[model samples]
Target: MAGSEGPLRLRDWLVAQIESGRYAGLSWEDADKTSFRVPWKHAAKLGYQAQQDAALFRAWAVYKGKHLEGTDKENPSVWKTRLRCALNKSADFCEVRERSQLDISNPYKVYRIISEGTQGPGTILPLEGQPGLVSKDEDKQSPSRLAQEGSLLPATLGPSPLADHGYQAPGPTHSWSSTLSEDFSNPDFWLHVRLFYGTALVHEATVRTAEGCCLSPRAIPANAAAEYLLGPQPRMARVHFPEPPPGAGALRHLLPHLERGVLLWVAPEGLFAKRRCRCRVYWRGPLAPHRARPNKLERERTCQLLDTRRFLAELCAHLRAGRPEPEYQIRLCFGEEYPGPPDQPEERLVMAYVEPIFARNLLLHSKRLGSETGP
Candidate 1:
């Protein structure tokens, strides 16, 4: 055992960093997903230090337990997912949830002390499912609240696309049922449109499958969020919703189904189905993605946000046989420094042109979405 000092070392480092205001300069990510990004400069220190105190990583996990010094019998709703926006090699990535901001009262200190060493990690139960959606506040909100506060869908259509919350088959005599498994091994994609009301993430849908945003996915590992953001998700899921009839089944109506953060399957057109998963971050009109890259010397530079306006425009013209509407390619960019994955550049991207059915289906519902509501 590394004694109490093993975990205490980490606690000390975090305490010192807090004292020196390391967290004061945090990097932003897709809506509602805030990581306590380890600065690139500090990567070396954490790396060498981690080897010294192997238990350090245990203290860095997303653990849930009662406060070490609280009188209440129930655990306070405190969460800590250790991650930071860091280079893959550093292994220093960590997440700081909107609500999990640490104060001195945090129980991590007590848990770390009792746990002993890396191998002897105590019972600080780690979070199992999607770490993105684990915030206490989000737990309280039902699907209805999310729609009213976050979605662009009409009030009537939302809350639940299925009227009964759990709907039966079309006929009175028939009932269709399928069990949903906790094992989300089935691959899919989520199409996310995060609207930032000024700096606050008003509407957040992380890619739970591919159509949502952060505070968003299970497919994405909590530690590798930066890499996922900077690159395209590799999967064979082809997402397509049924085209609705003329008026009622317009983009707005289908969105309740399309962008609901779940995957829809269709029979393949041929031997294979098209698999394209692109994640684009849109800022209000005339605005670009926030630039938050750090120098190589000062920070590890784990990811980058790059824009894809020029390419999408040319492609739009060639495909549609005419120039796209003025509001089509509003000022938007890929949230990371690079667009698409390595050896492939054109695939994972889109322009927010609201024609529906095509041109980034159901992406930007309305042109004025960019500046519809004032900051």
Candidate 2:
């Protein structure tokens, strides 16, 4: 009996999760330990990706900083003077030899000095008769004079140019919908907003085709506000999600919400009002619910109702089992009261529905144990 409380304790918890937008960790291994019969492929895949993505992001950051392009190096002229002074003070009279035979094995070691100083090598020593070398006449000039020339040395030392280009790290390729309707013909100024989950996320960014343009990037920690003023554009504007809340990454669960990216119309004329002046969007992406084939048991019941509460409760029980399912799908709805236009007295009700489905589609073979031990 799959009711509010029954044999499947996990099912009850799932009901609560659906209503409040919370999820319980359900992995295949945990399911095995808990002794439930559900398959583990979906949950394992989800956990694997989450872990991989985290590692990839960290690697990308370190690589990017270490290989920053166009960043000027330490001025060579400064380095030369600094190296010369340090070598003169050192007790080892191997400065000139060390500089001439620069050990490539150790880049961090003290640099050698090439000069007529007592600590320098005999070959480069200031001479009464070395014709083409630092001649007797040239020795008259002070070290300070030589230091000035060192400054002109080029400052481009690091990774090869090809290694430092901005290449995006590897990950699952996302297939965006063709619903994007960027107006290529419009010559007048138009602001574009990249929206997702029935809400304008990035905000209204100003667009212009003129010299000197910039774009700002922002992220929403949580799903809260909309209609942001993302200052004027032609600027490369972007919106990023910091960390997805509860059920975001799990596609099987949240597929309905991400069915289509949303859009909005933001014009400079009414920037002050922040009103829904024009152009309401209605693009939708794929949804798990719409794709869910009804269970054969419920085939005849066309009006079968899904109890939100029961689902949440069952979900929790499953998570508590320890070996929980890797993924789950939960439904959510949002409502806000917006004061309509000045002429319209009533506040408009803005409603949005979000559904998230968790699926561990990419788990490693070792983690996929349910099949080996037939449930």
Candidate 3:
């Protein structure tokens, strides 16, 4: 270990060196700086020793351990698996690959740590399915070149049609006046409509009823609708509910049931419009079942809200934004109120939900947002 430093500091510096590829083929400008700044908080939650924990600081920024910490005490194997996933995501493991084909660029390069020319596992990313440690012969194959041998791939819906002349699913086609009832004054009714119509009607109705603003607008693209609904808060999921005829089958079951956090899911097709609407709901977070369905043959469960006020606050923020009567989308927020430092009351976990068209695209694009495009 380096002189005058504890084991933790030494390990952290080692991780930075590995990340910069000083021991590999390449070296980065500020890799060492980030090592201390990155994974300190995460290592604390993981219960890593001071020395081993510093290694984490050299790699990741924050840790996600609220739920997993308890589970780790009861189950060792599961904990290691979870830890492995978090640690494996460091830049040292990432490789340049063909964006379109997702194939690794180099086959001969393999990354490992060396001390007096001996191998170690401070920051290692072995090929998929193989042990985190691989033999020198196996180094010929780049970790990035390995195929996803045993991962669950998403359901392929064929190449994207949106790139063509606007892939559109027909929305409900009826005179605007025909759908609104004489006494449909309730805010909840509008909330349901927003989920199905993708905010085209929600904003229009709000302006006409509450603020009386006359705004001519076009359909709000699905993606913008969701982000707009989320307002400034970072939302991770969206939820959908069923329309009346179904008597709240799956929709009824899913509410904010988690001890903390939110839940979102796809809205049922029946609830949205007389004719099928292309819009989909993006439910945020995972919650337990509100109430089990009566006819649940397989006995599936659902979720419910833990704090209605927080949910309403986030929802209102979206509604009150400049576009009172937005044409493209409608959104709702959910929240939970937790006690903070003494004498201070603050709302936590403000989540939002919107139509799926917006939600799905946001998720797919988020991971690749700033990444440079590949030919």
Candidate 4:
């Protein structure tokens, strides 16, 4: 009677039998040592013979026509490799990898063959350490075992004094300058400023802050108040700045403070309560200490600065056309160091998001905008 049921029922029954100690000291791990006949009806329903043939063809394809010894394409070693590769390519497999925090590069660590069934192929299951594969009792103790750790911090900020040409402060209500003036020295105040802008740099920094504060990036208390401040869909725009002459790069002693600037307007519900928006100047860039050797960090900072400048310029043009929602201009000053140069004066902007997904999407959109605008 039990054999007539499908694999799901069979799995349950086998688990129960093992828990009951049906085979004396034998454990569930030893179930493969014993075999049970597959009911004829179940075998037919599963198309066992066809599945075996298909599995053999798949294994053969993996060899790319290289002749294997005999007709043993069903060899356990050969089939397992093909199966593992096939499983790894599946969407479910990727989801499992993310949830279990499994190393994507490690193929052998993910799954194991649990049973070589009598009627059909073996059953492959995620390994013991995989999240959903763990015992239910253990899962009950911690529902979200695969939660991500740590937050991200902003990579950079700008318009440096040298790059600040054409920049204009937004109107009073939406002015970041006004807010900063009230608490210019406070790191916490900067945190609020970043939250308002909600750029990728701010998001990354917020993640770092959450980790340092022992708070989950997903549920930072500071982010709760400004949740609605961010527009429903964060947008990306491109700004065009005069390109430095090819050979002039080496001799350029100083970058501009305002490459160009614009004014923006926001609806009453936008970041500012007033209808007018002003661009507030803030610097964001690599967090590495000034003493660190120049390497990829320097290159990245340069690229980010240029991109941000272009984005802001494009945004200014976009605002001039008139937008339906409240708008604000953000001035990004790129600097070489966190403390920056003595003359430049660095300002930190720390921002937080409810989840990394929102932050990631915003960054992606910005990248897309940059790409569309070209170098």
What is the lDDT for 203 in model 1? 31
lDDT of each: 0.25, 0.23, 0.25, 0.24
Candidate 4 residue 3 C-alpha distance from true site, Å:
38
If both were scored by TM-score, which would come out higher, candidate 1 or candidate 4? 1
Return whichever of 2 and 4 wins on lDDT.
4
Global CA lDDT computed for model 4: 0.24
Backbone clashes under 3 angstroms, per model: 28, 50, 39, 49
Worst 10 residues of 4 by lDDT: 268-277
RMSD of 3: 23.4
| TM-score, candidate number 3 | 0.18
Residues 159-277, model 2: lDDT tens digits? 12112212121222234211112343322122222223333231222232211111211332222121132112222223222233455454223323322112121111110011111
Per-model TM-score, in order, reads: 0.24, 0.16, 0.18, 0.16
Q: Tens digit of lDDT per residue, candidate 3, span 1-375?
A: 334742232224445555664332223324433222122222224343443433333222213332343343333323333333222222222212121121222112222222322322112233244343322211133211221122211112113311221112235433331222234232221221232222333211111111011111122345553223211112222223222234544332333221122222221110011101112212222111212211110101122111122222222333334222212232322222222345653322322222323222222332233243424
Task: Tally clashes: model 4.
Answer: 49
Kindly give the stretch of ten consecutive residues in candidate 1 with the minimal lDDT sum: 266-275
